[model samples]
Target: MLRPELIEFSLDNQKAELKIVPNLHGPITEDDLLQLLALPDFSYLCPLHAVITQAVIQVNQLHPQDEGNIELFFEIAERRDAEISFEIASDKMQASMALTAAYGGKSLGLRDVLQNLKLQRISMGLSKAKIEALLVEFATLSPGEKCHSVIANGRAAVNGSPAKLERKVSLARERLLQPQHNSDGTVDMRNLGAIIMVKPGNLLIEKHPATQGVNGYNVYGETLIAKPGKDLKFTAGNGTEFAANNPNQLIATVAGQPVETPSGMQVDDVLQIKNVDVGYGHVDFKGSVLITGDVGEGMVVKSHGDITVMGFVDSATLEAKGDITVSKGVIGRQLKDLSLSTKLIAQGQISAQFVQYSQLKAKGNILVTKQLLHSHTQTQQQLIVSDASARRGDLVGGKAEANKGIKAVAIGATADTKTELFCAMELTELKQQLKQLDQSIKSMVVAGLNIEAQLRKLPPKEQWQADAMMVEQVKVMLEEKRRTVVFRTQEELEFEALKLEIEGYYKHYRIDALKHVFSNVELHVGTAFQRTQREHGPCQISNKNQEIRFDYSH
Candidate 1:
């Protein structure tokens, strides 16, 4: 055996050199070697006057006629190899075999010479470590998980076979996963992905708690989402319909391309929400907090602009600098410390049973059955009824200490200082008492006595007479409540008119209303911003109670 193209030469120091110049970076195929070896002019460099002729021993290794041909083949191979400068990367089989057969087939240093070629590649700057990393061959199919895309080789089972290795399909998994093969040709395992691998008759699951079939996997034409809970858990199978698992924490797709975000962005972009539902965690947005769906418990939301919630704000504190508009009623039965801190404009009424310290405002008149619209102690805080509003407040406010009574419907403005005659003073007092009665009626509920808890026995009609007596007492109490309420209202209104005079000094008009805050984070509510007035129907149910008014000058 000889390499017809590789040549043998001697250096100045008389050291022999063997060289081969390969044209392309191709493995030496059998057909290529056959064409070179079949040359009739090949060999003849070696003259074998063997010692086997004298002792008649071991003549089987070399034929006398073939000695010249073998030398000629080596000489031509080495000469051609030197003419070009192709260096050997790997001397797999035929090159090693031919060189050994020509020199001395079982040479002592043959293995060492082959080993030096692998080292020579490293010294030439092509790291064997890198080359070894790139080249890999496997017998079985890949597991096919989506980790990376690397070139793969599927080789023939028989060694030294002329047939080529089958072309391998590039898979997604990082590892070169394979199926298990027994000596008797029994393949008992084949991997589908990291999660599942199968064999001929038995399936060896790679993960525990794994389901056995793909019965519940529902794949839409667009996306395949793994529903892990309930009866949706199923093991993956080998089919075009099934895809290998993608185990990334987040997969975001934008436009038709995927946008890979670098972990978390800056504060300006931390709370980022796209159109898709977050499905699990509290979805946050740096922009206006909008909930297309109902907010679950333990979800806190805050925003700079207004918060528009299409669902209930239950057990959750939704806040914003702009108005908070809740289309649905708030549900917590009673919010003990609820505080709505803006002109809370609601298309729906607040039904949290009772709010301890909460407040709401509408540029339009307020309308709510179980909600109260309280006046602030020190602003020009007054409940005024709009002409469009149908629901009226049982108006009450006064200051007993100042001995001033509130004027209903501007009985006296700052422009006019004169008082009316005392002709209908008695009738006006009775009318005030009746107005107080209405407020009391709005506040109270019919009592329900637990009959089982009745410890003292009394006459049946006695309970009814006692109720009647309580009613009369209530009438007196309401009248007194009205007087006290009116006194406070009058004093506040007088101060409001006075504050307007002071504020007018700094405002556009000689007659003024709004005060100027030198500094503070105060919201600038739109002057024409109208909050909803009715909770039930299309009527304005305003709380024009104290009847405070401060019309602004354009």
Candidate 2:
């Protein structure tokens, strides 16, 4: 075990000294001497150690009286100036230096240290007064004694501010005023408040300009470039445009809802359609959509904003970045007819009067007013099926999964349609992911092993005796292979993190059937799952003590 601390260098870098601790860890070998020659700090002294056996002999002869007292006395050369070793901060914002007194010659003056800094390319933020004081302090210290002081500091670069959008009016405040739920826990579907409308020439959004950031220099006088703030442009959709007088001001050209889009703010001018049939091709709009008639089979509607269907939707596909509201029923063919079956995916909340044989997925809540029959619905948030008017909403003959919770007036029917409901159910998905990660990691490990084997066989750049171009190409290839190994290691770290997360994470969720829960209804809560053999009037399903528990409310 040869340590770099055991080796010492002269102040002028002309000679070297080896120290021997009191521990007798066997005699020094050729390999030990070779290891010392390979160190970065001693690479400058490689010309001094040509013979490995001679260097090993020098190390083996160092026998100290005590392990603590291991400093060897070296004969100082004719005239050595004081050694100034710099220590720069990791962030390059501060720099300090330590002075080792000259052995048998004059100490360094202020001019000498300044010339040394110049040679080191440290031209910025020099403290001349501090250097003068440090020179005086160094004079008081004994020869070979060390004194430390701050020499230079650099200013850090300032990051620019991000562009901002200032809104004149807020639709979020109006939504807060309009309550979604009544005192009875039932949703107030009708009193959800009117849409926020903006008049012509009304300023919807105002943009602030981004400013350039100031540049800073390091102790080495190298410029540290600053990152300017991200600039944003107003996204004026239909019925909206930039102001004629001011480009930064976004104003509404017509009356419409002032909807905040992902890019910026926009006036959500609705696009009304009589029907979506074969005659009318797929509808893809940047704004909200309003359909008065039905969306016939094989039709597809996509919008960056919300999609509202006043009439029924039959075997159609509706994809919206915002919410999807269907006034009437959304009917679809069976899952067997995968191509023609209705599918609805929304980033926001989804609300429908009734959904049958359709597939629905939403980031927010999925609200069904009447019934969800044989539909596979999933939501990151809660899923509720309750009709305020009829007081009868059922989830039957399908899979309903939600991360938060699931609430319905009725679950399953007398026919025992094999309905399945899940709350916070992610075990299967996680297991599948683990399987994929395992496969990927195994492949990466094998590939990394092959790369390492190839690297071991290839000669290093220093040892190569090939053409310059060939050596350069080989060096690049080696670096690329090593980078692949590094990437594989990072992916392995991610895989381990996923495993740890799966081990520690537990989903907290519940399922509530306000009315009848018929037989053959399968309920899954977290990791616990069970099926109802007999009908239950009303019950709350949850996981307790790692087991599925059914609490009858009435």
Candidate 3:
């Protein structure tokens, strides 16, 4: 039997030599050398198979009777690669180590394996327990045996959340348009449920901010940044303010309907009424008026804000600081006493489904969806009589006047009903009224200037010495300040009114008859007038300079 000690390696283990002692009893076989090469101490050097075979043949060639020494030189190399190797993930979130028994070279220690991992930039999540376990297992393994295990891991980053907005009030206006049913199972047509209203200091909306997410790290010791949440801000509109105690909370500063705008919320002071009939007396309110039902004969309805009539207004007197919207018709009788006729006036626009035998006046436009028949319609802006959906309507037997423009599908009936359409005409009565408004505005301005001068002449409050004379002077100053406020308020109102009047006077005057103008229709623009000699189709009459010009589309 060949002993493992018979084989010897060079100092660097790059070369090896083996000696075969003559077996007096038998010759050495190939299996004998192979079995010797498999020993733990000598197995590190791989055997050259051809060299071993030749050595065995030469040993057998020797006569069994003659004993001799046999020496063989074997080629070998040191295993320079480490027994422990690492595999890292592309994202650096996982790392694993592979261990094997070394041959012809020194086996790697745990420190060596760790150093190799450091060179790969994997420094974050190394597990000492796993490394020690793998190293112990590697030590106990036979040559060329392999052991693989995970050694490191990493954390993933998380994204943040977005901010949220909470509304305290129901800003939906659909409920206002829908009629509610009574407990008796009957629909209250006149009482479309009460409008959403908010008093002063009532909460309207609140905002909650976003949060920053937690950060994470990888096996490479690199920081993973977290995405922060999106933040939001409260958008406050007119008559709305942020709460004194909470900056995130929004509140209303007036008693009115809560209107949701694109950017935020607004509060408009409004007066809601079921009807303007015998049950309700002559109504006068400082805010907008919402009439759910009809306004009966001789009923007077007035407001500082807009007047919205869900139902009809029949032979009633209605006035408003803002627009007037009649969902249904405005009906009246052409009586000898004009005061008995339906009179609807507004500082803003007036819109109606239909107006028959009524007097309509507005500083802004007058829009009629259906026919405006036998009515006296006056507006500083356009007078339009066309169905909004069908684009068809008639200005039949009416005296319609405007400064800006007029548009109608048909002017006068096919029966040649007399119709008058006037634009930019300077009426003596309107001129007088304008003059009176200008004078009133001038008077207020003068009074405001006088008040300012008087206020400036008064002693400054900081310089006043506390005494009986100072007290009396202070009282006089307060009274003058109150008077100044009153005059300033009135001046602003009058100035706005006058500005609107002047704006109306400087409009470009034009009239468009979309369909046809009957023969009896009288067209007037500025200082010029013309009567349609015959039925005209699709024509436009405009005041250019001081003359009226007609353009026929067809």
TM-score of each: 0.19, 0.44, 0.43
Candidate 1 residue-wise lDDT, 1-554, digit = tens? 33644423355312223233222212233344334433543231222223213212222223343442232211222211101012221321111111112221122232343364444331222233433332221112121111111111112122121111121221111111233466798743322123111122222122222222222111111122222211112232221111135221121121111111112101111222322223545544443444544545445566543354544554455544333444333443223454333223322121111121224432222222222222111111222211112222111111100001111111112222222211111223444554565454334321112222232243464565569776565565556556555444443333443444433321221111112101111111111112212111221111122121233232
Please report the candidate that would top TM-score against the real structure: 2
| Candidate 2 residue 491 C-alpha distance from true site, Å | 21
- lDDT per model, in order? 0.27, 0.74, 0.75
Error in Å for residue 195 of model 3: 7.5
Q: What is candidate 3's TM-score against the reference?
A: 0.43
Off by over 4 Å in 2: 1-197, 200-254, 258-266, 335-340, 427-508
Q: Which order, best to worst by TM-score?
A: 2, 3, 1
- Model 1 residue runs over 4 Å out of place are 1-284, 296-298, 333-389, 392-554
Off by over 4 Å in 3: 1-255, 258-266, 338-340, 426-508, 544-546
